[model samples]
Target: MKTLSLFIAVCIASTCYSQLKKLPIKKTADLHAFFHYTGKGERIISGHRGSYLKGYPENAIETFAYVLKNTPAFFEIDPRLTKDSVIVLLHDATLDRTTTGKGKLSDYTWEEVKQLRLKDRDGNITPYRIPTLQEAIDWARGKTVLNLDKKDVPMQMIADLLRKNKADHFMMVTVHNAKQAKFYFNDNPERMMSAFVKTEDALKEYEAAGIPWKNMIAYIGSENKPANKVMFDLLHARGVMCMISAAPVYDKLATVQERAAAYRDIFAQGADILESDLPVEVAEAMKQKH
Candidate 1:
């Protein structure tokens, strides 16, 4: 009986790992092709902070895996620098909120950071620890795409890390403006970017910067508004996918029905991608639309 139980456990674990959805992008060209808008109403989902599931701490590899097991999606994660200049996946500048540790994250070395356990959104401590940026890039190779949100880490450092890992295919950086986008573009013209093209002016800036539209997915904004239509028409014409983040807006809806309706509305309005804190929930909500 003991031998049978151990065999069952191993089989279950293998099945779970095998069930994960993967984005099999092999190079920068493939990544760009994946994000290109075809205007067939294809909707992509991205997990904000990896996901906001109970007991699965945000930005942890476990949380990312949990989402992939349920549905196909990418992740938008934060990268911050430690005292020793190591890059780690963490949203806040301080560790007090998401981890068992206190004080600013920059004060701790990676060794000290590794000793702390991660906490879920509800503040329940979990077995997962802080993951380094390198670990994330390595793990996401063929699993899914990772969009690295801008934090305290320098652009030079991020570029160096991506080069070291050869992760340009599966990794993307979020740039707030054309200047930041140009920095990455000049470094590697093939690098993919999640750019903030929330306004016509912002869109013009990227156009003026001369960064190829093939290398980007534009983030329109958090809400689905009438104004977004103009941006959508513009970007889609250029074969760029536009993303609407529901992390701040729709995910906060008081009930599941309301949130589901909002999620459906985002796609119906022609947004190609939806970034959310509740990616699993968004996936379920989107099912009813089809």
Candidate 2:
């Protein structure tokens, strides 16, 4: 009886690991190149607000396509879950502001939410329909990298979706703080974090938990900088990359030209990738020196 029980246990363990292994995996270079890691340059242009600066809709599929075609600029979009547990592209806690729809966004399901169109910041309603995460993945495949801004969905769902769709090759996951990162990673360590550079206590906790350093991206907002070169240095030394705004603090910057310049300067600080809303503008600026 003991031998039979042992045999069954081994079989179950083997099957579990096999399934885990089959989950999609992404190479650091495949992701690194999406940021336009030129053999000689500092940062790759990132589309801020999904090319919203160019009149493209934020978090819209068309905007993603536009950014992919115009330049190597990577795309950024936010994800929020509707009431039914279906994830949708949204930035706010409610849809009353970004959409023509009324009431709290969480009140709707993917089916119900899909009926409404997105309204631009100017109040001109776009023809684009709301798309699910799978649709977004299909849109992005072989074209651009996805900077996933996880807002509402549970981390378990994110992991399950990645495992189910085998999507790790095209997307990077981020958490606002280290505690969230720990919860997500601990639940399923197979997933990865491109950035979680918030607290040393969290960092120490992560290290102590035996999670490998290579799995997390590092970031630090410098007072001298939004987060200075030290952010890059710390992460680079650990063999991971750092995060910077695509066109961070654009309104605060003295001028659009200065904002574009900041993108490159962040790259020069040793950042492997940059996130920007003004990708086309910055791309043009970078082209001048070439």
Candidate 3:
């Protein structure tokens, strides 16, 4: 009996060691380097709604998983509250467009929300269903980062959830202005935030608001060309990455050549990140330029 017990203990120890070896450990400095401007201008990609047009359901964990596996990109997922106050991944106020159900998302309880199947970008019902915010957070651990786009939920509530899950390191919350940035920075200075910094004046405003520049990715909102060279230079100088969103606008550019040209110009202007509906395409374009 003693020999048998020893053998079992050895087997369990080996199994545990093997499992630990399989886990991917992301360094904090590396994650910061990926999202911050280092003057070298390393490019990053964010999948808008998790590559929804590539047959994956928008805002679904499966879609995000597919993106991380296929491309070196992070995912932007929208989180909204259900009737029971559970936060879940969703892009619209109503579930009619993305799901089989026809009602306001907040009107449905989580149990009911889980039953509705998600539709593709083309409106075809897929096997995926709405995932809870916690579910997405769990999936992102050691895999990729998630950019939380503000929907109906309060930023404080979202921050609380991130703290609960110990996921603040692997996610960033969207902030529209300096005031929002200051609000979040005051809560936890370590939290990452994405906000618009369209001009040199915007940078000055952020400084005056006491926003943490090290924990920010400035979204220089420009249609085609980069927002402003001075703005880009200032952000980079302060070690803040400049993100150019190519969605619902530049993504709809007339032709493939035009879109490609626009992306090239964005990089040439020293933009560190590209948030795109066409994440895979943008990644490929970046690769070709390199």
Q: Which stretches of candidate 1 lie over 4 Å from their true place?
A: 1-15
RMSD of 1: 1.8
Local error of candidate 1 at 260, Å?
0.5
Top model number, TM-score? 1
- Model 3: lDDT to the true structure: 0.79
Q: Give lDDT: candidate 2, residue 215.
A: 60
Clashing pairs in 2: 47-276, 48-276, 48-277, 194-217, 221-227, 222-227, 222-228, 246-275, 246-276, 247-276
Model 3 Cα displacement at 117 (Å)? 1.0
Query: lDDT tens string, model 1, 146-240?
Result: 99999999999999989988889899999999999999999999999999999999999999999999999999899899888999999999999
Q: Candidate 2 — what's its lDDT?
A: 0.63
Q: Point out the worst 10-residue segment of candidate 3 by lDDT.
A: 16-25
In model 3, the clashing pairs are: none
Task: Please report how far candidate 3 places residue 218 from its true position, in Å.
Answer: 0.5
| Superposition TM-score, candidate 3 onto the true structure | 0.86
lDDT (tens digit, per residue) of candidate 2 on 1-290: 99999988986643322322111224654553433323354455556557664245678876666555556655667788889888888878877766778887799988899899887656678877677888887766655666677687788888788778766666767766667677767765645565556555656666776666656655454222644554455555556556666444752477867766665566665665566665666666666652
lDDT of all predictions: 0.92, 0.63, 0.79
